[model samples]
Target: MSALRRLSLSGLATATAIAGVGVSTAESAPPPEPARISDVQQAARAIQGMTLEEKVGQLFVLFAYGPDAHKPDTRNTTLYGVPTPAEVVAKYKPGGWIYFNGRGNVESPTQLATYSNQLQTAAINTGLHVPMMIATDQEQGVVVRIGPPATQFGGNMAHGATRNTADARTAAAITGRELKAMGIRQDYAPVADVNVNALNPVIGVRSFSSDPQLVSDMTVAQVQGYQRDAGIMATAKHFPGHGDTRDDSHTALPTINHTLEQWNTIDAPPFKAAIKAGIDSIMTAHIVVPSLDPSGDPATLSKPILTGVLRQQLGFKGLIITDGLEMAAVRQQYGDAEVAVRAIEAGVDQLLLPPAPDVQFNAVLDAVRSGRISEQRINESLLRILLMKLKNGVLFTPFVDPAKVATTVGTPASLATAQTIVDKSVTLVKNNANVVPLNADPRKILVTGWGVSTTQALAASLTKRGATTTVAQTGAAPSDAAIADAVAKAQLNDVTVVITQKAWDTTVTDKLAKQQKLVKDLLATGKTVIVVAVRDPYDIAYFDAAPTYLATYGYAAVSMESLAKVIYGETKPTGKLPVDIPVAGQPDTALYPFGHGLTW
Candidate 1:
């Protein structure tokens, strides 16, 4: 802290201080050896004295859940009459924690700091005094887990829509700064995946652009901004690229058929740039690339890709983290314990959110005891883990002031920065027939549904814009019959706004049929049918004949509000298509390419 402070002070003392830390200092006024050594040097000395159990503990990063965010993997069992995840920290003393749920079940900022501090206090109680790294997958707008009190920046696809790298940088800086202030020093973000595949289920708006160069440039800028501006470690993720695969790895194993050349040209540039830019961590994708490893193993468990490509070929010396091993991608085949051992053998430095953390930890421990995994391998990962803690300032600054949380989170400056990104990223993809800048009255506007919650979310945003918005009369679930009813109500409105959302890339026959029916019926009435895509922009390809089309790239509150504001001509739509939306004739390319957007 003093080193950073002194560097800011303008004086000859800077040179004096520099000379003091030099290899051979002046004999007359040699700097006293009373202070501490560098984070790297300190980490090196600390590891030598650690026990094998303690060292192995640092290899795992497990999830700690808030009440409302509990999933199948979260520990639901109570401990000491408390429903909190406090017991998990005490039992494992793992190297890190993944904080889910920034909304319900999470207390106010001050209480959140207290909870984090309490966890840290329990972790260091083992006498090793090691600090645990707290992290989140705060990938901006769409995948934001931390709620109010945190500025939700417009996501990566939004950044790409603006074609502005600085927007990406500033949003990341704000996110990282606030996260750090709340005791989280790491974020898994700035998705390096180039969303080249129009039907990519997982990497849609979370990715920056279809163009590799644009993704690479924006990725590097995001890393720099997060680390330099806010002093937090930003991880470049889904490495070896999870962009082109059609399957969602959360439920299935996705495959990328691209050869090494294709991977190098399209998928590898961002990882290379991230490495060169001093990114602290790199996350492995669970997808399979047969060209990289013919055994059909996913990249997370493939030695050739993890060791040969990422570490040896790419020259990334930082920590290598695996995507959540609990996902069906790896879990369906390899049991909890077995895959954990394989992941370590694959050259991964950390196992992220392994299902059954105890089972996985014990599996690796047994592997070491049986000589199946060597102590040397353990040392290599241990060294990286310890160094990361030190270099990222998690070692000395283990605790944060609970009272100061209010001043750091969701400040006016951060929210303003977020609104700027939103304002710039709400894109107008197609406005044929001048349907947008919808009539100033906007008194009788009908919003059709896909997902009821998302429909209501967009309706709320429209309502804020002084539009009399009504959710269509769709049944419990979106179906052809339900959409038929919705179309009947939509025809009564002065203008109908149909908001579409798509997630899974496969088996959408029913959805496609319903959407076609809904739009056809509404258009038959001769009322203006305005299509606003709240999710992936590619859904536009299914209904290209709609008189007007727009892409918000997300359905978040900010994204919806931006979409509504643009419709009212209150905020100019500046965002362009981050990915190509193919028309009827053009098969593989975008009808609207990158850097194409409009305003009325």
Candidate 2:
């Protein structure tokens, strides 16, 4: 054991004894040295010295239950029979931990930092003494895990509209700085997928742009900001691209029929740029790309795609992590254990969030012992993992000072930067009614829309701007009563602002049809109507009848305030359309072409 770890353990035992608890002989044993190899050769030597179980353990990044690392939660048990996150870490010895807000893994910045420190302490107590790769999908906008006191910046599409690489870089740097402050070392962000399909269900506002060059530039900038500027390992995700799929991998296995030429031209450029910029990791998509792999397997389990295309053809040298293993797309063909083995066989360096960590870990361990998976293959992944840990400061600084988390995470400067991006990225798509830049005299405005909280936020912003605002709550699909109430409210207001939210690029739903009906109904009132798409820009294509329209690409606090400013002429719209808005029900025709924005 290193002297520092031994001293820490000694102090712990002494404290326990002082509390009248006896110290066992097990507590007296020296712990292992910290995993802090500075070079690849040193990492290789450390890997060589590791036991087979320890080496296999380095391949998985599992999720455990409970908010506090040390607090036992019998209600939510892992497959390994562990009750606490620290126990899970000690028992499984996995490479890392992936946190999810839905899983009750995150609450606030200081609490999360404390949780991380506890886990790191548990990891050090184990035989490997390796620091973990603590990660979370803080993708900002819609896919955020940590919320509130953490500055809520707009997502990729919001940055895409700004058409500024510097904005992307600044956003990523701020995200990285905040995450790192909370002891999170890996961020699955700056999605590099080129969104070409208008009907893509999942990658709509999460993607930077439809144009490959724009996506490439933004991806490179984010990669540099996260990795170089903030010292966070940025992961360029959904590799081999998930932007063209009609189905979401979380529910179904989507198939992309991009020809090799088309894939190289459209989807490959952003990933190429990310690789050139030295992105630390790439995440594999669950979608099947026939052009890259003739076999019907998704990219997560296809050797030809993960090994041949990504590793050899594209020459990517970073860690290749599989998307969440619990997703239905990858689980459709094989059981959990078999899926884990196949992922290892397919050149995946890290298996993310296996539903059954123990079963998956043993499967890979048995594969090595049975000669199905060569130990050299395991060594190759371990070396890469260790190198990443070394480069990203996970090995050197595994724990964060919880006291500093609050000051570092959501500073005034970071919030200002986020607001600036939103202010610059709010696109005024149409102003034929000239209803925007509301008159100097206070006007009674009605705010109603799809998301209740988002619409309420907009109303609050408008209210702050000295407008007489009345808000009517609306659901994802407005009910008849909601529509009636909104219309009644609109009758009292001089101008009605409707906020529409649709994150998916899929076919128009019955809910969307009802939303369209609501907008048309509001327009029929003959009062000045302003339609603002707070989530997806394509929402305008569904109801183009509204004479005054705008697109904010997100509904974050900064975004809503910026939208209010644009509406009141306090901020001029400078954003261009990052992705083309296809005509309703017609993906081929453009209602608003890319880079289309009107400034008054």
Candidate 3:
């Protein structure tokens, strides 16, 4: 019953642009209203006084390499010419920044806050006085850029397992609040990807559900939660869906084969919901949808998709961000320069994580100077960027107190909520012999997985509940010695629990094959095998012969605790599966459909 395709970005072009700015194009659509009338006026006033170099800088959102990266000597091999610290600050000051794990060498909260302050201070020092939109990929479940002390909330698929929008909203709010406290102004989150393909390596658990309506509802709720609670910009991302692809855009270009009509029906709902909910931004996916443009171009480089479909047809009233331009999907096809020119031409307001910031900035600069791309086009993007800053309280307030950073980041309340969500989301799909809630006398368990820490964590959590637990290797690509040791332990234990971890590699199927063989080998030991898919839900398909199957949907502490509690009946298995797995031994058929789950 969600709003299927009801988003109308009517009059957004005129409202979002700086109000009353005269343009040479007489018939140009007026800017859309995304900020207060006075804020728009202020933005217009500010734009009227900017230089071409300053305006060009507003289009880029580069990565903060690290604190020491500011020095001139830290330069590495340049793919596209890398920017020196001095050059970046003086010649091509970027308008925004994005942080991923280890990007800024963020070892602590104070360090991150101080570094963020330094970045903002540098931007201000460039004499433009414009605040940068510091964003981080804080999608919570599997993709957390900020490390621990930040609450490990249940991911999107976990939220889907509960089938509750209210809880999803709460989790998003907590994420937003924590992000704001850490001095990050924007979060690229609430992955609106619909997990239609269980084989999707990157988007499996990051997605909310296979059901379009469920994804739509959760997407809108999370966006609203972020804006309402944290007052930070929440992005609805990987537009047109990364859910159905077998490839990850991070490494390659994926093509979605759906027609326009088909696209409208399935991959389009969550984005529409985000637009209708007044979401601030929509991130472009790098996937190719031939239905939109037969040129085999990814959506990031496709004008038909960005301007024609998103800007015109869908009426999205805010900023349109390109997925990380450094990603091999686009990076492989074009030079760093082409990435910027084509993306801006395609109507992207912001370019994220450019491979080489200086090169991209220079490329854009030359293009505009040569009139290959007009100054007006740059102004359009700049207006949107300025409006976002104004609306998000960044234009006037751009500083963070380093001392308060750690104190405000994570709270016991948020962790408790995370634990509640994890407890509620540990899905049990199959218990052939009710092997769960470990009713066996003097239960002895052997946990094996890819990461020793995670395997040991699960074992430790179970051990605290009075069970004799031991851990083996992750079994991703188990060595013969490891296999022998695991098999030896398996024979002694009543149940051999295989904590399967999905790999994000071009060689994923081969790794899965190795893991499948290991699981089959454990089953050969004539002992009970309980397969816990700590990451991908499709894991059950690879080893369906096991006596038990569980999907934790994450590997966070909360997730491990949930697994422990579910095993001992401390937390009842109440979650339902959000995605379907291929029927065992039937690749052409779906055995456990979306929303299929079992509890004992």
Tell me, by lDDT, which candidate is best: 2
Report how far off residue 206 is in candidate 3 (Å): 1.1
Q: How much is 377 displaced in model 2, in angstroms?
A: 0.6
lDDT of 2 by residue, 438-494 (tens): 866878989987776788889899998888888886766788888888998899999
Q: Estimate each model's TM-score.
A: 0.88, 0.94, 0.90
Q: What is the lDDT of residue 303 in candidate 1?
A: 95
- Could you list the CA RMSD of all candidates, in the order they appear? 6.9, 3.7, 8.2
* Candidate with more favorable, higher lDDT: 2 or 3: 2
Clash totals for all candidate models:
1, 0, 15
Q: For candidate 3, lDDT tens digit of each residue in 44-127? A: 666777888888888887764555335443442253244443345545567787776764446766666666666665665555
In candidate 1, what residue range of length 10 has the lowest lDDT sum? 4-13
Superposed by TM-score, candidate 2 places the C-alpha of residue 165 at a distance from the truth, in angstroms, of 0.5
Whichever of 2 and 3 has more TM-score, that candidate is 2
**Model 2 global lDDT (CA atoms, 0 to 1):** 0.84
What is the overall TM-score of model 1 with all chains considered together?
0.88
